[model samples]
Target chain A: MLPVATGEFDLIRRYFTGLGGDGDGIDLAVGDDCALLSIPADRQLAVTTDTLVESVHFPANCDPALLARRALRVNLSDLAAMGARPLGFQLALTLPSVDVSWLAAFSLGLAQDASTFQCPLVGGDTTKGPLTLSITLMGTVERNHALRRDGAADGDYLYVTGTPGDAGGGLAIMTSGGERHNQYLLERYWLPTPRLAAGELLAGFASAAIDVSDGLVQDAGHLCHHSGLGCTLVWDQLPLSTPLVDEFGVEQATRWALSAGDDYELCFSVPPGRAAEMELAMAGAGEQVTRIGVMGRGISGVSCVSSDGQPFRLEQAGYAHF
Target chain B: MLPVATGEFDLIRRYFTGLGGDGDGIDLAVGDDCALLSIPADRQLAVTTDTLVESVHFPANCDPALLARRALRVNLSDLAAMGARPLGFQLALTLPSVDVSWLAAFSLGLAQDASTFQCPLVGGDTTKGPLTLSITLMGTVERNHALRRDGAADGDYLYVTGTPGDAGGGLAIMTSGGERHNQYLLERYWLPTPRLAAGELLAGFASAAIDVSDGLVQDAGHLCHHSGLGCTLVWDQLPLSTPLVDEFGVEQATRWALSAGDDYELCFSVPPGRAAEMELAMAGAGEQVTRIGVMGRGISGVSCVSSDGQPFRLEQAGYAHF
Candidate 1:
């Protein structure tokens, strides 16, 4: 049971209602049973849902605001992976108990990110329960133009954005000892940018794309699973963040780069001849990516090869929260 | 940590992925980053989110299939309140452990409702945590056709569909000693129908609308608050089901009807001039309603009037989760 202060706060009106935009596409906002939105008839709506539970998906005592930002960023990454532009979002948050300050900090972080992402909080629900945040992000894309996982063909080159696995490095440092204040790694972990521009750009060039959440290898395996093909990763070409490499060493960094989760970066495949044009388009967009593998036929799943072209084995794939 | 058996279940592919409609308006169904939906150009998308947590919202040992149906039906009630037609839904479930039989029953209930309501299951997430379920239901309505709470005017007649307090009596029976086996009361509590037809009909005639989740008085208060008016519910006119009255008597049933929560029936305001035509339309639609009150200006919040025209005092308004 929560303290009576929970009711005194009037969470919907006091906190959640004022976070979104000034009624751009929203015909109605919070306080109602349903929020109505007009998505220009030319575009199709893209929706995704992601949930984070305390002590399961995240540290139990993480900063509330940072947790809020991280939760939203991860869900937004889903839309980014789909090449969908921001529309709005609905949050269904379950809490064990209500602490005014904790709620204040949490809402502040949500408001901040909601503004940054240009996605308003169209509606939401708050209930007393174990602490968990589930966000169903809604976005829009041109009709029939969404980047899908099954579109990539054999021989398509696999590409990844930013240096992957810095988030896992951050997690390792945070859990290992008193190095939780490592700014770069922690920022990467909690606030990995949702590559909206890159996703929208790639929608036209990349045959298929997905954001790196469940580690590079496992997530690529998802693409292979969906596309009915296999992929080979050039072990030496996997991008390793400089900070991660410098702190954890190349061996540890490579392991994190390939096998750790929470990387919020895009992984896509470019058709052979379209690579040059896609790269050229991406150069000026401030989104850097490295070609790490190529999709091929007649294989079971994702395989990796060292620079010498010898098969490399990854001891474990990635995290699964079941 | 959850049992390694959770990983063994592959909850999404096995249970959730196959619950939705047969690829209608769904470009990509379960595995993708976002569920792409092609909402017709002439329609506006109406969205709502609802969550239920174990121990707080329900008994710890409620039947899995019934719980799943109740959860989804309650959320669908919101869509009905808005006069929206069902499109699809997303479920984010947090489970303490993976039970194969429980998952099977829960998904069966969800699939049943998905077919019954014509709302497909578009996507979902399953995670390890204290048991909780969050659903975001999406639907569509013609532009400017949504039945909303802000449209009622002073002097409008307040009407409610079906009997309002049966669910409350059902809950009372369940929580008191050993009346849980009372089929009529328990069924009313667990399987309250969403007044979709009534809502769609009301959209064309009612001034304002909301579904009864927080009891009659409080939900009517919501309509008043949003419409910038006050409403008076005639206690004598409050609809009480025969089963509830049979067990609890008239006085007790009146209290439950006016104050207890979890009635999925719709409470709406109809303009004075449209009552006859509205009632005629409702008659042919096979939906029955009772006019219980009237909206007025200058009075704050919800007031109750006895049969003799004196103010009737209600001990409590409704349930509030904090």
Candidate 2:
């Protein structure tokens, strides 16, 4: 059973007001007609918006706290891909009914993540509807230094941070009930960490970057399409979690890495001559940078090849909401 | 019947990309991980988000084009209240299924408003869900010059721009079907003009301001609550439409003006000495500015009284979404 909401204003005051401190870049927070934000003079604002619907983005009975975190994290991932430092976000949450306990847990999770990422809740609207969460995150990047998808060159080397297929494997586990007790996998599905630090470090070194939300290959194809180039992803070089490899064989793991979605890891391209320097920089920052593929001058798509130079046929490219 | 959407990406490319131009303070538009925005050095960003859900926010079968316009206009009204100049907006649209005709009409209405307000479409997300539209609008105001609700003084005279309760009367007409042929009231409900020019003019003169969204009396109460003051509104002073007076009678029209919501006009307070100056300023700007009441140093709430100084009783203060 869900707790009843007392009223809209009361709910917002109780659950959202203290989500984060107002001092960072927000001149004014909630309770006003609009929030006043002061962006640093040297930085440009990076803005993105995303929406998640119940039963479509997650299971119907999923934990509210995790749902809130996922909703904010996915949007933060977009900022990370653009090499922007998270500043704050506004939430538009629609609920089927006022559920006090559900809201309490959800707000607690949101507050925790807001604190963790230093992205405060600035302003938002709460309305009655089918359960849905929409977040618009704002960040700042140095003028002309923000990473873009159309900057990849013909000889750019593709690199990815973190394992690509773990979230998909986690989703598969949750859906199939094959490993119901796999907490790691469940955590991967519910709590994706945006690669903010890695992206920031790669800002000057990377030619093009994108966060892997719609599977590695499909998103790589997006990068290629924007850059007017193609890519050759080495199947053996694809990163996979130990648990994913243990549960699913090499072939399945590779397939998930290429075709499954919701990774939330940064995949970027570096100029061929700067690959070694970029790797050193990432290593110095204590982040993993994996060499995954290379951009080529060809049709805009990703071609997968095995270690022995054999072509691998993928069943599907990635997940599409439509 | 609704038309079918070709695909998500294709639909966005066809209908939404051309919604606004790229040069108006937008460094990067759509097709990127995040849109980049450049705020003037002397200005602070004013951000606000609002969500509209089908059946809850509007009639279930409301026209898609009208729905889109209402969604954007309501958010723009918030900017007006803040005395901010419109810059750009991000949209998160969720639909139950692909509806090509609906999307085309919706995007057309959205584009028209974006162009009219000079608030371009910066970024957005589209997902599959029950029909919902969430828009986060961004604007700019000179630092420390934003009109706030907490700035009213004890001796401030209260004022409003345009007639209040017209939209409520419009809504009443739509609900009862008594005057389906009343195009004026129907247009009032479907399309509200935000008092941008008036709000901008009020920035330096008005002590505090707010958009009359939750009825004139209730929203005035909000101003009082923020300013730690009280207000006494002259019941007969409220501006009412001629049609509203003719259809609902003077008594009910007075009640609607006092308690019915969705006016979307600016309600503000001016220091006692600035009333004439404000009137002159507004006259110069060719906008209506009506003096309706006065702020007082007392318990916080709106007190309504008739022309004879007798207290007026209201059954409900305002509309509450919950």
Candidate 3:
């Protein structure tokens, strides 16, 4: 699927080949049949893959650079959830046609994020097809230090980093073709930061962890199901960005926070006894986390309750790919 | 783009989750945020990515099992070209819709090949789109033993494993839909064997190596371009299958052998002094290799000559993606 077209190499060489510079743990980079990567012996490789379809995942026509950033960042969020430090990534990008300017912006965006996360673009594959991006990002984690869904225990404190569901709201705004007054929401939609530092900090400490991609409540279900526990999320404590709340109002924001996806924020659980200490550690590291729920065995599945012990329900579970 | 639709998990859990099995170098396999893998510190990872789009790479409708095999084998071919041992692979499949029986067959095909190659399914991302499969396969190779295009010397024997161009002939047969009588060519097209063992045997021996996927002439040009040498391909020395020769005749067979792609065979070069020794080594391994040409600095690019010393020419270079 490579030896990609005539100018495909030019596109990659001109825009992408320079992404992974010297001393990035890459023994050999592009132009070879395979990229030879040097992973530290003591560290285990953490591999996560994500594929974004043009019409299904994002707007058909948007900033290509932002799309590139979002694609890489969301995958980084997975590495973050596993408490793996960024290493390098392979991008298999399919396009319907070659657009030089679009590729320029896309590669630029990838370059920026690769630099920001210290994850260089080690290798890539390009083909002609409907615009699709499949990125396989690898990271390094200390042996047995990966935060997993099964690590959670009953009665652990569930914490979420940053606001959840703002990106979903941003998507809503973009889809409606509405006035783009809320730059914060748009940026959140375009750039959902991967909590890499927080993930590294929480590696051995957190009981269980996951990124809020397919909504907070649904992904929380995964943690609960895998851990054989149930969770109770307090509606009032849900972290909603001010812009999202102001634009979509509290009820919608509450639903978005609970049901809408594409947040990319970390939703992790820690032992209640260590909750205060973990919070302190995160704060010291310049990260913000809100304790919005508690893991328990009382509930069968995920439950949402308001201040008065009132039950809250979601219309749909989360984003689904069929 | 996971957290798939209602039946998506059912599809994955039923057909895919059981692929890697219990022990295959996967610390953590599917269903996790990231797959935890153990790569020996001394060995570098040989990573390659490939994407096959529907109607572009293969027929719109075909046996899902063969398609799956082709998808994985071509990528494995890249690993074999680098003389790397297969470790694991991640498949990102984007489909227009979920088909149950299709997935069952596809997963079965993948299971057979993954088990045969010793490359387990580490992780995967499934989404909805115009049927596209992007696979990122990783292998482990000794730090400095990887055979590269640039490793060739000015004077070396250009050797190829197995017969090339049969798969291209197979593709031609498939597209015309004239007759399916030639099962050999069809199998060659569907299952281009990845010469993994030969690659391992050639690791430190061969000066340069590349899998013949994008036509022998073009790929050989890559070897010449990178190694700063030209090549003289002896036309009469090329190995051709009896079935291919009978079906397409000698002229077409010669053209196909010279310029058609999708052969998945290894085209490698070794110093002339060691060519016989390397040939004996390959013979010991029960693999066949033919010295079809010689690499040299005599010409600026690739030149082909027949037995009578007449120069040969082609109508087209090879397949182009765009």
lDDT (CA) per prediction = 0.86, 0.87, 0.87
The candidate 3 chain B region of ten consecutive residues with least summed lDDT is B1-10
Arrange candidates by DockQ, highest first: which order? Answer: 3, 1, 2
Error of 1 at B230 (Å): 0.8
* Model 2 regions lying over 4 Å from their true place: A1-6, B1-6, B178-180
Which residue pairs overlap in candidate 2's backbone? A3-A100, A5-A98, B3-B100
Per-residue alpha-carbon lDDT of candidate 2 for residues A24-116, written as tens digits (9 for 90 to 100): 778988988999999999999999998999988888988999999998899999999999999999999999888999999999999989989
Per-residue lDDT for A6-123 in model 1, tens only? Answer: 2722766787877856546777878798999888877888999999999998888789999999989999999999898988899998887878789889989999998988988999
Residues B1-322 of candidate 2 have per-residue lDDT tens digits of: 0111236777777888958565568998888999999999899999999899988989887888889888888999999999999999999999998788998899888888888888889889999999999999999999899999999999899999987877887888899866455677677778988888998899979999999887788888888888998888988988888987877788888888887777789999999888898899899999998899989997347888876887777778888778
TM-score of chain A of each: 0.96, 0.96, 0.96
lDDT of 1 by residue, B148-256 (tens): 9999998999999999888898898888989445688788889889888888888899888999987888888888878998877889888778888888899889888
Please give the distance, in angstroms, between residue B207's alpha carbon in candidate 2 and its true position after superposition. Answer: 1.1
